[model samples]
Target chain A: MLEIKNLHVKLEEEDKVILKGVNLTVETGKVHAIMGPNGSGKSTLSYVLSGRDGYEVTDGSALLEGEELLEMEPEERAAAGLFLAFQYPVEIPGVGNMTFLRTALNAQRKARGQDELSAGEFLKVVREKAKTLKIDADMLKRPVNVGFSGGEKKRNEILQMAMLEPKMCILDETDSGLDVDAMRLVADGVNALRDAGRSFLVITHYQRLLDHIKPDVVHIMADGRIIQTGGPELALEVEQNGYADILKAHGLTEAV
Target chain B: MGAAVQKSTLEARLEGLSTTGFAPAARKDALARLVAMGLPGRRDEYWRWTNPADFIAATPVPAQAFDDSDEAPVFEATDRVKLVFVDGVFDADASDDLALAGVEITRLAEAPDLNWASGLYGTLEVAGQTPVARPLAALNTAAATDGLLIRATAKAEKPINLIYIHRSEVSDPILHHVIRLEEGAELTILENGPAGARFNKVMEVDVAKGARFHHVRVQGRDHERRAATAIFARVAEEALFKSFTLTVNGVLTRNECVIDMVGDDAVAHVAGAALGDGASDAFLHDDTVFVTHGAERGESRQVFKKVLKHGAVGTFQGKILVKPGAQKTDGYQISQSLLLDDDSQFLAKPELEIYADDVKCSHGSTTGAIDETALFYLRSRGVPMEEARGLLVLSFLADAIDEIEDEGLRDDIVGRLEAWLNRHRD
Candidate 1:
């Protein structure tokens, strides 16, 4: 359902290239895990796909169900069924979380020519989703992410993803800064949303989150390029043996 | 109606004042001081943001005669005891003399004696020191005919509301009110400007030790009327004073507030919201002085918010002063404005003066259009642009309106604000 062909991205000010000919494709009903060390351009890929400003797409293209996703605005991309669970959610003071979420949801609905939901109906749906996600109703009343703890912010991100219900979801370092319990809870939330005709790309540094979601395909990336692709057992192999041995075996340690 | 005419006519009228009062000596001295000051011009430091002389010069109408019409108040169903004043004169028939446990409500002219009147009159006069030497104040003192005086004795448990309603027709009317809350006493005063009338009014409040005073003023005059009012408050040791002014209408409106935190451990919060539109020019100037005379732990805060649309102009100027040896003083002032239309304009200046080293003081001012993200967010939620703008503006002014302690008064002001928004919404 989602495809990225030789996607290349570079910073505008400098000659530094962040993504180098990265290629990935995920069909319906499958979860793809992209495991990478630091500086492997995982988060950058998420930003570019989500249409965040200031990221220049030098070459290649990204498509969601055969529709061009790169040309849309950040909000438009969100409406086009592309969701990026941000690593760091922006804190908007004086804007309540429910107010923000309702705005986003209704904006997408209105763009698609759908009838808007009443406040009562919207609150009902939100409360049900929030209960399953272990989010308190009071948190929805507060200003978005202001004074929220690290784990709470991440949970908020998942809650937003569930509310938006995009066709393709990209989770960037969702496991970072989460305890073992929070990690399992978040994994469970993601697993529940996974279904036929919907796809997910879970990006993480550790194999702990992978144990719960159980991806079908695993890819290891280094130096802005994907170098290895294997089954789920490949994750445990890399967990026991670090990336150095894998790079040495692939002859990519000295290729650069 | 224009700036030039407003300025010239006000000048001519001030030049023609024939001063007469019970305190003729003080009135004459104040008039001479006003003449020397000669209606603050743009060149003056304090009047830079809003020039009353210029506004008065254009629409120079004579002092209005008393209108005894039984015009009902816009805010009905108020629970607090009411004292209404019509056309600068006290309305005895429209008010109730409630024998509350610990309050006193009486007219200034009918006080049997002039003891309190003599002491409270001219208390807020600048005495030729500052540029805001009270030209309109002098006009009120010389021509006020009558006013209301509500006093709360020391440690009074109950609070009273003094309501002033202006009713005028062909001329501009003025009213002067003085409220004194003695030591440990508490009172809440609600003042509403008359609709469809030109009003120039002044009110002075003196708060004593450990006393608490709450004042809420709502100006909802018709767009054709012009209104100018000044509020002066003096706070004593361990006393708490709060004042809120909401201006939602009038062709030309200027509501100025001066708060003096004179005693140690005295706290004061002064806030206002000015919503203007349709060729209206609403100016709000807040001059607060935190005098820390050996009274440590004095605190003061002021916030002013203005929302302008349809070529309206809103101006806010706030100043906080910390005197020498007034250590441990905390003072903060912020003024923000939201302009809805390209033709609308907002000017803000926040000033802080500190003579002591151990004082914490900061002042900030910002003027801009509504947040585009917030606007788009609301519009995307099926709310029309005008309604969305109104909601945002309401939230913007909520910071100031929320300071009012009385729920009735707060809701009254909010209702007036909504009415103003509905009138100006496109």
Candidate 2:
């Protein structure tokens, strides 16, 4: 469902490189987990796939369903069924959460040449999805993410992912800033939306999140490149021993 | 004075007024006051950000009216006694009869005597001359041809709406209105439309003890007209006075509001929302306010928001003053602007003066472009860039818009703001 070939990215304003010669592929109906330590370009990969600015893609291509994703605008990529659940949801003051969701949904629908949802139709779907996430009507009525608790923000992100229903969903550090209960709720929300036509790219720093949303394949990423690919057991191995064993096994030393 | 100050072109034009129906003493006093304070020069501290040259010119450059058929003036959807004015002259044929229980309304042209409004006709305007010179308002008081005289003895059954329509290409309109709310009375006043090519207007209000007054005004819709308006109000003991103004840009528009809380426990709030997106030379919108807390334990708030795009300019000069004996006075003032483009400009001057030791007064002013992080978030969620920009702009002005007391009127004003945003959004 998503393909990346020799993807190289760097900060546009500086001389630093983030992702260097990275390649990954996720097939239909499959879930892939990329576990990496801080500054290993995990979030950068997600941002590059979702078409964020401030990064120059110096080389290679990222395609969604064989269409060049990097060439499309962010909104266009969204219309093309690419969704990125941010690590930190932005707080938009004075913009009601429900209003933002409705606008976003209708905008995507219109961009894809589909009929837009009516207010009532959108409200019904939003309420139903919000209920499972434990988001009350008050949270939907308040400004987006403004004064929201960390768990509430994560749930809000999950609610958006459910509403958009994209072909490729990238959860970038969604487990960060979440307690065990919040993580369970978020995992439940994501698991409920799992379908054959949709794929998931779960990017994380720890193996705990992978336990809740078990990945079909686990890739241990270090220094912007995938060093190993294994099954669900690899996550438990990392959780028990940390990235030191993996780096050593790959004939590399951890930074002092 | 060794050398007489040269009469400005505007003053020369006022010199030709017949003043036939005006009270001689009042007109003379007002004209002398205007002459003493010559038209605010560009170098004047108050006029530094907003130039008065174009508005005070003898022959204002005429502008073709904008076609606003898709958007109706606020309050057109509500039922009220409409006081219509065309080219500064009262239009009786197109207006509802000035008939409402507990309220007495009169046209200034029809009432030639010193009249019930004598005490307030130009008193507030003259009193406002102290910290700075507002020569345009003084001129309006001197040469205004017609306006309304409203008196509310009890709760007004219906809101009084003053609708000004511009029909002539080269019209210059001057009007001064006086409003008095008796003790225990309640009233709401609504004003809308473009008065003329060059318009000068003044509204003086007196809210008595325990009275309540609500004012909502939507300034001219013409993009090229130059307008100067002032609101001078005095709130007495336990009275409540709240006023909100929504302005769309003209070539030059300046609105000065002066409010004095004279009686203990009185409350006053003055707010404005202005949008100016000059496609050509930048349109200018200015809100100048001076609020004084004179009595003990009074409260006053001043909020102003402006949205400027495509090289447009917005300015705010607001001050909150607490008298020496006005202990425990509470005052808050904030002015903010959203600059849509790099060429657009926002200039604000916020001041606070508290002589009373126990008073609490805070004032703030800010100017910024849209939040890029928030914009990206919205766009990533599939909202188009333009729509996202519009939403943020509206949100930037929401706090000030919420100051409107009437829900229906607030909705209508918000609709007008949305329409403006849609037209200007790229």
Taking all chains together, each candidate's TM-score versus the true structure is 0.75, 0.95
Docking class of 1: incorrect
Q: How large an RMSD does model 1 have?
A: 6.3
lDDT of 2 by residue, B196-223 (tens): 8788899999999999999999985678
Q: How close is chain B to the truth by TM-score, in each candidate? A: 0.85, 0.96
- A14-90, model 1: which lDDT tens digit per residue? 88899998888888888999987788788888878877555788998898999888887666677778787767665
lDDT of 1 by residue, B128-176 (tens): 1353455666666665556666678854444455555544554455566
Best by DockQ: 2
lDDT computed for candidate 1 = 0.71
C-alpha lDDT values of all predictions: 0.71, 0.88
Candidate 1 pairs with clashing backbones: B5-B57, B5-B58, B6-B57, B6-B58, B7-B57, B7-B58, B8-B57, B9-B57, B10-B57
